[model samples]
Target: MQEQKRPQFKVFNTPELLETILLHLDNRTLLVSAQRVCQTWTVLVQTSPAIQEALFFQSQEHKWHAESISSPIYNPLLVQAFRPFFPSVHEYPPIHNNTNENATEFQAEAEHHGRDEDSHFSFKALDMLSSPQKKTAYMRKEASWRKMLLRQPPVYGGVTIFKMHHNMGGDSCRSYEVQEETPQANQENKESDDDHKMLKMGHFFTAFIHNEDLYFGRFGHTRIYWSTYVPPYESDLDGRAGGSYPPQGGSYSRKVIENFAREIVRSEVVAFSREVTQCCVGGKTNLTQEESLRKEILEAESDDRV
Candidate 1:
């Protein structure tokens, strides 16, 4: 007998009930793509801020957690890595993704730890992002990333690609590209006639958020050049940026990635909130602090407590 067909979930269930179901379902790719097929779904999804955040904010509640600093962007960055095995980009569309809610222990580990980018990594990181148009790009442990990165759409126009680029224009917002120095490069810098920069590469990117254009490849971890946001983030405090990142540890690569990832995500969210404001030519953005001129509003909570 033909399986009894049922009404679409949206048609049968109320919005709140539907959202509760969406919250439990681990099928993000299918759900996200489905939102595009109908006005009802599109509105239901876009209006639900919780669902929007859930896409990027992997959580234990959803049975997903940060097993590695690289987990967040691993999907997109590893697309090139999985290309050779899959062979065709068209094969990895959003619809046919097999998302088992009951993922195996090792499978979850791979997803959290970046779908094996570390295993097949040729150098310290993975290889370059061979353009999708080019045939036979190097993929990490063929078919490994496919589990996590269900869909590999083109860079610019694909709806599934992480938001193409943030466009909050002004002098305050600044994009950064920080390359980690190898041991040889570190020694070379020390021997140079100029001052020595440590295992710690000198911080280059800084801004008061509202001041300029922003384009640090948040997810571009193509082993060729991994971009990083060097920190103690610049805040209202002078010279010192706001949040202090953990010190560079040759052994603790995971720690370094995790700290920077949090800071990067937080900074991106702030810029989107319109919190970044203007300043004069020689002035700084003072971004982390909100705009508050009133004395009571500006003072510390400890002042009231005391």
Candidate 2:
């Protein structure tokens, strides 16, 4: 036991090795908790460009990096930013836009190989979007939500909950509830703490390819007035020099792929959309109420048919 004391471990001496380790660290730990560990670590993490890039690339904006790290995730803006680090494809995959009839054709091929080739081909939007943000988790969350929504389809009340993005990189995406015109009777009696707690953070976008499905973003959000190209002299002109790009409550697609996704998700997005205001994503009461109401209504309607 005394002789074992002679075997002292060599201390990690280089900042580069530390940088790589820090880069690999969980984002929250690195930002909120890790830096506070020690002065040397704080300086190293704060000053390291690689760490900064890693953090930036992990933002909800880079839904692809989180959701689809294996195959090429198709966001031009993010691709440009990360082009230097990207593996150069010896030959660019042929543009499948329009030339292919099925927008989801790539999915069939992915499915054949199954998880053997790609674990994330199924594209778990919410799984990739968890608070701590893990890079490679398979997600059926969206599919499960779809089943829940479609099982008892809601009346076309319009988008109750909308998650919309800041164009390019304007601001974080946000959700707005339709704010129910019918106020609850016990509104005043309800404790303030009982009110739905709004989680302020989420991912929203016009279009992204996840598994076989075309998702607007990893999360849901509605359209905003942000657009670079404002089509003027159109019949439905937004009544300004630069009108709302998708038009308010209009088509959310901007790019070719977005247009395709609009077609795919339109019915699904619309059926679930309602007109409730200030509703928060995953708000306890709000979420429970919506799910319960939809479940009841759908079941009742099915009974009526029976």
Give lDDT per model, in order.
0.28, 0.31
Instruction: Give the distance in Å from residue 241's predicted Cα in candidate 2 to where it truly belongs.
Output: 37
| TM-score for predicted model 1 compared with the true structure | 0.25
Residue 163 deviation, candidate 2, in Å? 11
Q: Residue 187 lDDT in model 2? A: 59
Off by over 4 Å in 2: 1-13, 26-29, 57-288, 291-306
In model 1, what lDDT does residue 254 have?
35
Residue 108 deviation, candidate 1, in Å? 23
Worst 10 residues of 2 by lDDT: 144-153
Write the residue-wise lDDT of candidate 2 on 119-190 in tens digits: 111212223333322321212233111211111111122232333333333322223323222236545655
Q: Clash number for every model?
A: 18, 17
lDDT of 1 by residue, 1-306 (tens): 223344564443477776666666454443556576678666766567565434422212223333432222323333343332221121211112222322233233434555334321121121322342221222222322222322211111101101112123421212243332345555656443121221110111011111223212222111111112122222222112112121111112234334344444433211111122223335443432112211212232224335
lDDT of 1 at 292: 24
Model 2: residue 84 alpha-carbon error in angstroms: 31
